[model samples]
Target: AQRVTQPEKLLSVFKGAPVELKCNYSYSGSPELFWYVQYSRQRLQLLLRHISRESIKGFTADLNKGETSFHLKKPFAQEEDSAMYYCALINGNEKLTFGTGTRLTIIP
Candidate 1:
Protein backbone atom coordinates (compact mmCIF):
# COMPACT_ATOMS: atom_id res chain seq x y z
CA ALA A 1 0.00 0.00 0.00
CA GLN A 2 1.13 3.54 -0.76
CA ARG A 3 0.80 6.41 1.66
CA VAL A 4 1.04 10.18 1.39
CA THR A 5 1.80 12.51 4.26
CA GLN A 6 1.45 16.28 4.43
CA PRO A 7 3.19 17.64 7.48
CA GLU A 8 1.18 20.82 7.69
CA LYS A 9 -2.59 21.09 7.85
CA LEU A 10 -2.56 24.86 7.54
CA LEU A 11 0.02 27.31 6.35
CA SER A 12 0.01 31.08 6.35
CA VAL A 13 2.31 33.21 4.24
CA PHE A 14 2.62 36.89 3.65
CA LYS A 15 2.06 38.21 0.21
CA GLY A 16 5.27 38.20 -1.85
CA ALA A 17 6.89 35.74 0.54
CA PRO A 18 7.99 32.28 -0.41
CA VAL A 19 5.72 29.32 0.33
CA GLU A 20 6.39 25.67 0.68
CA LEU A 21 4.03 22.80 1.37
CA LYS A 22 5.80 19.70 2.47
CA CYS A 23 4.81 16.28 1.15
CA ASN A 24 6.24 12.87 1.65
CA TYR A 25 5.25 9.46 0.35
CA SER A 26 6.03 5.87 0.99
CA TYR A 27 5.83 3.37 -1.84
CA SER A 28 7.84 0.39 -2.88
CA GLY A 29 7.73 0.93 -6.60
CA SER A 30 8.44 3.90 -8.81
CA PRO A 31 5.55 6.24 -8.34
CA GLU A 32 4.25 9.43 -9.93
CA LEU A 33 3.84 12.57 -7.86
CA PHE A 34 1.36 15.36 -8.36
CA TRP A 35 0.18 18.53 -6.71
CA TYR A 36 -3.51 19.39 -6.76
CA VAL A 37 -5.22 22.57 -5.74
CA GLN A 38 -8.81 23.48 -4.97
CA TYR A 39 -9.97 27.05 -4.82
CA SER A 40 -12.99 28.47 -3.10
CA ARG A 41 -16.11 26.68 -4.32
CA GLN A 42 -14.12 25.22 -7.19
CA ARG A 43 -13.29 21.69 -8.20
CA LEU A 44 -9.92 20.24 -7.46
CA GLN A 45 -7.52 20.75 -10.35
CA LEU A 46 -4.06 19.58 -11.21
CA LEU A 47 -1.35 22.08 -10.35
CA LEU A 48 1.74 20.26 -11.43
CA ARG A 49 3.10 16.78 -12.00
CA HIS A 50 6.55 15.34 -11.63
CA ILE A 51 6.42 13.91 -15.13
CA SER A 52 5.64 17.25 -16.67
CA ARG A 53 8.25 19.26 -14.73
CA GLU A 54 6.33 22.41 -15.44
CA SER A 55 5.30 25.29 -13.22
CA ILE A 56 1.68 26.29 -12.94
CA LYS A 57 0.34 29.41 -11.31
CA GLY A 58 3.86 30.28 -10.25
CA PHE A 59 4.07 27.12 -8.15
CA THR A 60 6.47 24.26 -8.68
CA ALA A 61 7.27 21.01 -6.97
CA ASP A 62 10.15 18.69 -7.56
CA LEU A 63 10.02 15.00 -6.81
CA ASN A 64 12.94 13.92 -4.68
CA LYS A 65 13.19 10.17 -4.92
CA GLY A 66 15.97 9.87 -2.38
CA GLU A 67 14.07 11.81 0.22
CA THR A 68 10.70 10.46 -0.87
CA SER A 69 9.43 14.00 -0.90
CA PHE A 70 7.53 16.26 -3.28
CA HIS A 71 7.34 19.68 -1.68
CA LEU A 72 5.36 22.43 -3.40
CA LYS A 73 7.13 25.77 -3.63
CA LYS A 74 6.45 29.28 -4.81
CA PRO A 75 8.95 32.09 -4.74
CA PHE A 76 6.36 34.75 -4.26
CA ALA A 77 2.95 33.78 -3.06
CA GLN A 78 0.03 35.72 -4.37
CA GLU A 79 -3.33 36.34 -2.79
CA GLU A 80 -4.95 34.12 -5.36
CA ASP A 81 -2.69 31.29 -4.32
CA SER A 82 -4.58 30.85 -1.11
CA ALA A 83 -6.33 27.54 -1.42
CA MET A 84 -6.26 23.88 -0.50
CA TYR A 85 -3.22 22.01 -1.68
CA TYR A 86 -3.03 18.24 -1.83
CA CYS A 87 -0.15 15.97 -2.62
CA ALA A 88 -0.92 12.78 -4.47
CA LEU A 89 0.90 9.69 -5.59
CA ILE A 90 0.18 7.00 -8.13
CA ASN A 91 1.99 3.73 -7.82
CA GLY A 92 2.47 1.04 -10.42
CA ASN A 93 -0.83 -0.51 -9.43
CA GLU A 94 -2.57 2.63 -10.69
CA LYS A 95 -3.94 3.42 -7.28
CA LEU A 96 -3.87 7.08 -6.32
CA THR A 97 -3.15 8.10 -2.75
CA PHE A 98 -3.64 11.63 -1.49
CA GLY A 99 -2.40 13.41 1.57
CA THR A 100 -4.68 15.04 4.07
CA GLY A 101 -3.97 18.36 2.38
CA THR A 102 -2.84 21.79 3.58
CA ARG A 103 -4.87 24.95 3.44
CA LEU A 104 -2.69 27.84 2.35
CA THR A 105 -3.64 31.33 3.46
CA ILE A 106 -1.85 34.26 1.94
CA ILE A 107 -1.97 37.21 4.26
CA PRO A 108 -1.95 40.70 2.88
Candidate 2:
Protein backbone atom coordinates (compact mmCIF):
# COMPACT_ATOMS: atom_id res chain seq x y z
CA ALA A 1 0.00 0.00 0.00
CA GLN A 2 1.24 3.49 -0.79
CA ARG A 3 1.15 5.93 2.11
CA VAL A 4 2.17 9.50 2.72
CA THR A 5 3.45 10.59 6.10
CA GLN A 6 4.07 14.06 7.41
CA PRO A 7 5.79 13.71 10.73
CA GLU A 8 4.99 17.21 11.92
CA LYS A 9 1.54 18.31 12.88
CA LEU A 10 2.55 21.94 13.05
CA LEU A 11 5.50 24.08 12.14
CA SER A 12 6.01 27.67 13.36
CA VAL A 13 8.51 30.17 12.11
CA PHE A 14 9.18 33.90 12.18
CA LYS A 15 9.16 36.02 9.09
CA GLY A 16 12.28 35.83 6.89
CA ALA A 17 13.36 32.53 8.47
CA PRO A 18 13.86 29.39 6.48
CA VAL A 19 11.27 26.65 6.40
CA GLU A 20 11.36 22.95 5.70
CA LEU A 21 8.54 20.44 5.87
CA LYS A 22 9.46 16.81 5.95
CA CYS A 23 7.52 14.23 3.98
CA ASN A 24 8.07 10.53 3.45
CA TYR A 25 6.18 7.99 1.44
CA SER A 26 5.96 4.26 0.93
CA TYR A 27 5.12 2.97 -2.51
CA SER A 28 6.04 0.01 -4.66
CA GLY A 29 5.74 1.67 -8.04
CA SER A 30 6.54 5.04 -9.49
CA PRO A 31 4.41 7.74 -7.88
CA GLU A 32 3.65 11.32 -8.76
CA LEU A 33 4.36 13.64 -5.85
CA PHE A 34 2.81 17.01 -5.09
CA TRP A 35 2.56 19.61 -2.39
CA TYR A 36 -0.77 21.29 -1.82
CA VAL A 37 -1.42 24.35 0.30
CA GLN A 38 -4.59 25.81 1.77
CA TYR A 39 -4.47 29.31 3.06
CA SER A 40 -6.87 30.71 5.60
CA ARG A 41 -10.42 30.58 4.28
CA GLN A 42 -9.23 29.38 0.91
CA ARG A 43 -9.44 26.17 -1.03
CA LEU A 44 -6.44 23.93 -1.37
CA GLN A 45 -4.23 24.51 -4.40
CA LEU A 46 -1.13 22.92 -5.81
CA LEU A 47 2.10 24.37 -4.57
CA LEU A 48 4.56 22.38 -6.58
CA ARG A 49 5.12 19.03 -8.23
CA HIS A 50 8.16 16.82 -8.46
CA ILE A 51 7.85 16.58 -12.22
CA SER A 52 7.53 20.31 -12.76
CA ARG A 53 10.92 21.15 -11.30
CA GLU A 54 9.66 24.69 -10.72
CA SER A 55 9.21 26.70 -7.57
CA ILE A 56 5.99 28.39 -6.59
CA LYS A 57 5.51 31.07 -3.95
CA GLY A 58 9.20 30.86 -3.15
CA PHE A 59 8.88 27.20 -2.28
CA THR A 60 10.39 24.16 -3.91
CA ALA A 61 10.18 20.43 -3.41
CA ASP A 62 12.49 17.72 -4.65
CA LEU A 63 11.55 14.11 -5.04
CA ASN A 64 14.10 11.65 -3.76
CA LYS A 65 13.11 8.31 -5.16
CA GLY A 66 15.89 6.45 -3.40
CA GLU A 67 14.80 7.79 -0.03
CA THR A 68 11.11 7.81 -0.88
CA SER A 69 10.88 11.39 0.26
CA PHE A 70 9.64 14.70 -1.12
CA HIS A 71 10.35 17.53 1.27
CA LEU A 72 9.16 21.12 0.82
CA LYS A 73 11.68 23.90 1.36
CA LYS A 74 11.78 27.69 1.31
CA PRO A 75 14.70 29.98 1.95
CA PHE A 76 12.63 32.64 3.67
CA ALA A 77 9.29 32.39 5.34
CA GLN A 78 6.63 35.10 5.11
CA GLU A 79 3.58 35.90 7.15
CA GLU A 80 1.38 35.51 4.12
CA ASP A 81 2.79 32.07 3.51
CA SER A 82 1.35 30.66 6.69
CA ALA A 83 -1.16 27.98 5.92
CA MET A 84 -1.90 24.27 6.01
CA TYR A 85 0.27 22.17 3.73
CA TYR A 86 -0.36 18.62 2.63
CA CYS A 87 1.93 16.27 0.82
CA ALA A 88 0.24 13.96 -1.65
CA LEU A 89 1.14 11.10 -3.93
CA ILE A 90 -0.67 9.49 -6.84
CA ASN A 91 -0.31 5.75 -6.88
CA GLY A 92 -0.32 3.46 -9.90
CA ASN A 93 -4.10 3.35 -9.70
CA GLU A 94 -4.22 7.15 -9.82
CA LYS A 95 -5.52 7.38 -6.30
CA LEU A 96 -4.16 10.29 -4.35
CA THR A 97 -2.92 9.58 -0.86
CA PHE A 98 -2.50 12.61 1.33
CA GLY A 99 -0.51 13.14 4.47
CA THR A 100 -2.07 14.24 7.73
CA GLY A 101 -0.84 17.73 6.90
CA THR A 102 1.11 20.39 8.76
CA ARG A 103 -0.21 23.78 9.87
CA LEU A 104 2.38 26.44 9.22
CA THR A 105 2.26 29.56 11.37
CA ILE A 106 4.51 32.44 10.53
CA ILE A 107 5.10 35.09 13.15
CA PRO A 108 5.43 38.61 11.92
Candidate 3:
Protein backbone atom coordinates (compact mmCIF):
# COMPACT_ATOMS: atom_id res chain seq x y z
CA ALA A 1 0.00 0.00 0.00
CA GLN A 2 1.48 3.28 -1.20
CA ARG A 3 -0.86 6.12 -0.59
CA VAL A 4 -0.99 9.61 0.91
CA THR A 5 -4.11 11.22 2.28
CA GLN A 6 -4.89 14.84 3.20
CA PRO A 7 -8.42 15.07 4.51
CA GLU A 8 -8.83 18.84 4.48
CA LYS A 9 -9.40 20.64 1.24
CA LEU A 10 -9.25 24.11 2.75
CA LEU A 11 -8.23 25.47 6.11
CA SER A 12 -8.86 28.95 7.44
CA VAL A 13 -6.86 30.37 10.30
CA PHE A 14 -6.46 33.77 11.83
CA LYS A 15 -3.05 35.32 12.04
CA GLY A 16 -1.12 34.43 15.20
CA ALA A 17 -3.18 31.29 15.67
CA PRO A 18 -1.76 27.83 15.59
CA VAL A 19 -2.31 25.76 12.49
CA GLU A 20 -2.15 22.08 11.77
CA LEU A 21 -2.28 20.20 8.51
CA LYS A 22 -2.88 16.50 8.76
CA CYS A 23 -1.40 13.73 6.65
CA ASN A 24 -1.55 9.95 6.71
CA TYR A 25 0.23 7.30 4.67
CA SER A 26 0.25 3.58 4.10
CA TYR A 27 3.23 1.67 2.78
CA SER A 28 4.74 -1.75 3.09
CA GLY A 29 8.37 -0.72 3.50
CA SER A 30 10.02 2.16 5.23
CA PRO A 31 8.54 5.13 3.42
CA GLU A 32 9.72 8.70 3.19
CA LEU A 33 7.19 11.43 3.73
CA PHE A 34 7.41 15.01 2.48
CA TRP A 35 5.41 18.17 2.64
CA TYR A 36 5.30 20.49 -0.35
CA VAL A 37 3.92 23.97 -0.55
CA GLN A 38 2.90 26.05 -3.53
CA TYR A 39 2.28 29.72 -3.12
CA SER A 40 -0.14 31.34 -5.48
CA ARG A 41 1.38 30.87 -8.95
CA GLN A 42 4.76 29.64 -7.85
CA ARG A 43 5.87 26.08 -8.45
CA LEU A 44 5.66 23.50 -5.73
CA GLN A 45 8.74 23.19 -3.53
CA LEU A 46 9.71 20.91 -0.70
CA LEU A 47 8.71 22.30 2.66
CA LEU A 48 9.97 19.61 5.00
CA ARG A 49 10.71 15.93 5.28
CA HIS A 50 10.16 13.45 8.06
CA ILE A 51 13.79 12.41 8.01
CA SER A 52 15.16 15.91 8.32
CA ARG A 53 13.76 16.66 11.76
CA GLU A 54 13.90 20.34 10.90
CA SER A 55 11.51 23.17 10.39
CA ILE A 56 10.98 25.31 7.32
CA LYS A 57 9.44 28.77 7.33
CA GLY A 58 8.31 28.22 10.90
CA PHE A 59 6.55 24.99 10.00
CA THR A 60 7.48 21.64 11.45
CA ALA A 61 6.29 18.10 11.11
CA ASP A 62 6.94 15.06 13.21
CA LEU A 63 6.67 11.57 11.84
CA ASN A 64 4.83 9.25 14.19
CA LYS A 65 5.70 5.69 13.26
CA GLY A 66 3.36 4.32 15.89
CA GLU A 67 0.37 6.06 14.37
CA THR A 68 1.65 6.19 10.79
CA SER A 69 1.06 9.90 10.56
CA PHE A 70 2.98 13.02 9.59
CA HIS A 71 1.15 16.17 10.49
CA LEU A 72 2.56 19.61 9.68
CA LYS A 73 2.31 22.28 12.32
CA LYS A 74 3.09 25.92 12.98
CA PRO A 75 2.91 27.73 16.25
CA PHE A 76 1.66 30.91 14.69
CA ALA A 77 0.05 31.08 11.30
CA GLN A 78 1.28 33.88 9.08
CA GLU A 79 -0.01 35.37 5.91
CA GLU A 80 2.89 34.00 3.95
CA ASP A 81 2.20 30.53 5.22
CA SER A 82 -1.12 30.55 3.47
CA ALA A 83 -0.72 28.29 0.47
CA MET A 84 -1.56 24.98 -1.04
CA TYR A 85 0.09 22.19 0.87
CA TYR A 86 0.50 18.64 -0.37
CA CYS A 87 1.48 15.51 1.49
CA ALA A 88 3.60 13.00 -0.40
CA LEU A 89 4.88 9.51 0.17
CA ILE A 90 7.76 7.72 -1.52
CA ASN A 91 7.86 3.97 -1.19
CA GLY A 92 11.05 2.29 -2.36
CA ASN A 93 11.55 3.04 -6.03
CA GLU A 94 7.90 3.67 -6.64
CA LYS A 95 6.71 7.03 -7.90
CA LEU A 96 5.77 9.69 -5.37
CA THR A 97 2.12 9.61 -4.41
CA PHE A 98 0.67 12.99 -3.51
CA GLY A 99 -2.56 13.92 -1.86
CA THR A 100 -5.09 16.29 -3.43
CA GLY A 101 -3.71 19.04 -1.15
CA THR A 102 -5.05 21.57 1.32
CA ARG A 103 -5.43 25.27 0.68
CA LEU A 104 -4.75 27.36 3.76
CA THR A 105 -5.92 30.92 4.21
CA ILE A 106 -4.60 33.18 6.92
CA ILE A 107 -7.02 35.92 7.77
CA PRO A 108 -5.56 39.07 9.15
RMSD of 1: 0.7
Give per-residue CA lDDT, model 2, range 2-49, as digits (tens): 899999999999999999999999998888999999999999999998
Estimate, for each residue in 20-52, the C-alpha lDDT of model 1 and write its tens digit. 999999999888999999999999999999999
lDDT, candidate 2, at 89: 96
Q: lDDT value for candidate 1?
A: 0.95
- How many residue pairs clash in each candidate at the backbone level? 0, 0, 0
TM-score of 2: 0.97
TM-score per candidate, chains pooled: 0.97, 0.97, 0.96
Off by over 4 Å in 1: none
Clashing pairs in 2: none
As for candidate 3, its clashing pairs are none
lDDT of 3 by residue, 17-49 (tens): 999999988887888999999999999999998
